[model samples]
Each structure stands twice: as structure tokens, then as C-alpha cells.
Target: MYIFSGDFAFLEIWYVSSSIPNMLVNILSESKTITFSGCFLQFYFFFSLGTTECFFLSVMAYDRYLAICRPLHYPSIMTAKFCMILFCVCCVSGFLCYPVPIVLISQLPFCGPNIIDQIVCDPGTLLALACVPAPSTELICYTFNSMTIFGLFLSILGSYTLVLRAVLRVPSGTGRTKAFSTCTSHLMVVSLFYGSLMVMFVSPTSRNPAEMQKIVTLVYSAVPLLLNLFIYGLRNKDMKDALKKVLRL
Candidate 1:
């Protein structure tokens, strides 16, 4: 769990850092302008880190499932070497998946009026600015987004489903309660992250009002990350005790 938490912490930091600084500048600046390369680069890093996050969440779910459902074999199966391998796989897969669509969209002609209505360089918004219609490109982007968002979401659900079954089988109520508490924080984070993402990305249309998009993007990208430490860290007994000690001092 600590290994997974360390990876998650790093992911969230980069994930938030990728766009928040630029967003703060946009808020303060008069022109509210970003160069073409800057926009795409932001789009690339934002989505790539977001994709990596989805993978890490699923990996964490799997770790919990193994720990809870297969405790006897977990130490052997999830060895240090195996954890490193999983980390590499998640990072590499997440970074590799989105380049094709980004490249395809970058090649589209943007003759004039290249204004993106949203604060972030969303693929949908960028596609709308193309001088020529890009139905094929739109379809490709939608397909990729849908596969990543839904595919990993279902995997999380599957892992938790098995976990739920195992928890139910524990004869003692205290045991069941402890097991549920262990998973509750992770489930909260997952719900916040995936719920906002599905609303923003998995839909068939990009017709949401600009304000609505911004709010949803903030919810997924910023809100969950801001609350992660509280959800995961503050809930720990050791962390709570430490906080109380600091307060008393």
C-alpha cells in the first residue's frame, strides 16, 4: 500500500502541476493567450498524466484486492520486483496511448480564428477550430478516449467486485468493517476522479457550455487532487495522532 501511495502521490503532484500554474497565469494575464505549441504540449502532458492516474488507480485497486482477498499469497506474488514492473507498465502504457490522436489533431489545418473557448487545450475544442471538417479525426479521438476511460473503469469495478465478495465472506463483523474501511478512501478518490472524467470525455458530443467544461475539468483535475491527501493521509491513525501532537505543541 505504501508503494502504491508513493506512486500516487507523485502522480498527483505532476498531474496538478502540469496545468494549474498555466491556468493561474491565464487568470491573471490580460491577453489569456497560449501559443499553438504551448497549448498542445499542455494538452499532451495533462492527458498523459491523467491517463497514468487512471492506470495507477486500477493498479492500486488490484493491490488492495490481492492484499485482502489473497493475503496468504500476496507477499510472494507482489514482490518488490513485481511492484516495480507494475509501476513501469503503468507509466509506459499511459504515456504511449495518446500520442497518435494528439499527432492526428495537430496535423489538422487551423487556417484562422484559432481561439479555443475553454481554459484548457481540450482535444474537442481544438478539433472544432480546424478550418476543415474532421469527422474521422473526431471519431478517432472519441474512440481512444472512450477506450481508456471505460476500459480502466471497468477493471476497477471488477477488482472491487471480487473484493466485496471476499469481504462478505469474513465471518466476523469487525473483520468486515476493517476491510471496508481500508478500501473506502481509495473508492472515494476513484469515484471523484472517474465520475468527472466520464462526464467530460466519454460523452458523444462536445456541445457543453464553456463554463460547464471548465467546472467539470476543475472537478476532475483539481478537486480530487486537492482532496487526496486528506482522504488518504488524514484518515490514517498515525497521521491523525501526529497532527494532534503538532497542534498541542
Candidate 2:
């Protein structure tokens, strides 16, 4: 889906491309020390990428809704110019949303232990390490995180609900199956990606066990990219043929 489609090309590719290499390096190296500035930059890009992903996925859901529910108008409505506008909006929004929160988190004093327990520079871990209690920054960051995650999630859900209704109205069984296959693959990837995020970030628990946090973070970071690679590579006929041609070269 990501490989062949304009909707997914930049955000998904950029995300997995940025994350996996760093993750691999961390795994390969015995030492996992990150300087304070390095940690802040990582946190900045990590959240920015994640926020961008949520926005892009919501854009995809909107695309799917148009394709499924308004087939006749999908082409007209989802024109290249319009898609470029959306792509720009997603990029701008993703980049703009996190810098202030990250700056706030960075300003907080880290007097004592500097070791971050997780692979990535998670905000929660940063909060834990703050020299003074920082309720205000916590509230700001959590509020932004919640709104971005749940707000986009709700939009995706609503779009898909309409899509399901439209799919059901199709007279041909084959048409319904085809629509469902596409939607099911998208939904599976969304659930895998967002479910882990919700558990890791949005859950009510104030204190998550460090080991559990690492495990969940690893899964959330790694699994969706692998799933997307296979789902699109093997299941998408166009993408498969394209890959074959590339391999032949």
C-alpha cells in the first residue's frame, strides 16, 4: 500500500527508514549512552515522526472513505493537487506540534542519574529523570499526545464506518470482498501501530515497569514496519510485480 500509493509514500517511508537503522545500531552496540543533546534530538524527531504518521494515516482513511463510499467522485476529489496540499499539511503539522513540548522537557534540570531505561528517549522516561517535579510540562505533553492520538483515531474510525456501510451496499459479492480485503489490511496495520502506542503512552498507569516499557516500545517501533513491508510486498499485486521487475534489474 505504501510503496505504490502517493498517500503513504513519504511519511511511512521516512518513519521506518529513520527508526530501523538507529534501532539496529543500538542493538549491535553494547553501550547505549546518548548525550543530553542527542537524547533531545532523538525525542524531537521520534515524536515528530509519530505525530506525522498519525496525521498521514488519517489522510489515508479519508482517501479510503472516498474510494469506497464515493467511487465516482474519488478521482476528482483526491486529485494530485489536493493530495499535495494534504501532504504538505501533514508535514507541517507533524513538524510544528512537538518542538515546544520537547523544548520544555529539555529545559527541566537532570541533576543526578542520566541513564534512560528505554531504547528511545521517551518523554515519560525524561519526566522520570527530571530533577524537580514537572507537572505543568507533563500536562502539556500528555494533552498534546492524547489529542493527536485519539483525535486521529476517532477520525479513522468514523471514516471506516462509512466505508463499511458503503461496502455493504455493493451488490456484487466480489466487490464487497475486494473492498473488505483492502480495508482489513489497512485496519490491521493501524491497530498494530496505534494499539501499542495507546498502551505505551495513553494508558492510565502512572508508573510502567521499565522492562515492560522497553518491550512494548520495541514492538511498537519495529513490528508495524515489518507488517507493512510484507502486507504490501506480497499482498499487493502491483507492488509485487514492481518489486520483481526491480529485482530482475
* lDDT string, candidate 2, 1-249, tens digits: 342254564566676655567767878999766778877877877778878888888888888898888889977888777887887898899989988988898889999788777878888999999999999899887887888899999999999999989998999999999998877767877898899889888864257788988888878777777777776557767878988999999
- What residue pairs clash in candidate 1, if any at all? none
Worst 10 residues of 2 by lDDT: 1-10
- lDDT of every predicted structure (CA atoms): 0.90, 0.81
C-alpha positional error of residue 64 in candidate 1 after TM-score superposition, expressed in Å? 0.9
Top model number, TM-score:
1
Q: Ten-residue segment with the worst summed lDDT in candidate 1?
A: 202-211
Clashing pairs in 2: none
Give candidate 2 misplaced runs (Cα > 4 Å).
Answer: 1-9, 17-19, 238-249
Tens digits of per-residue lDDT for model 1 on 146-165? 99999999999999999999
Task: Tell me the deviation in Å of residue 93 in model 1.
Answer: 0.3
For candidate 1, the per-residue lDDT at 50 reads 94
Clash numbers, per candidate: 0, 0
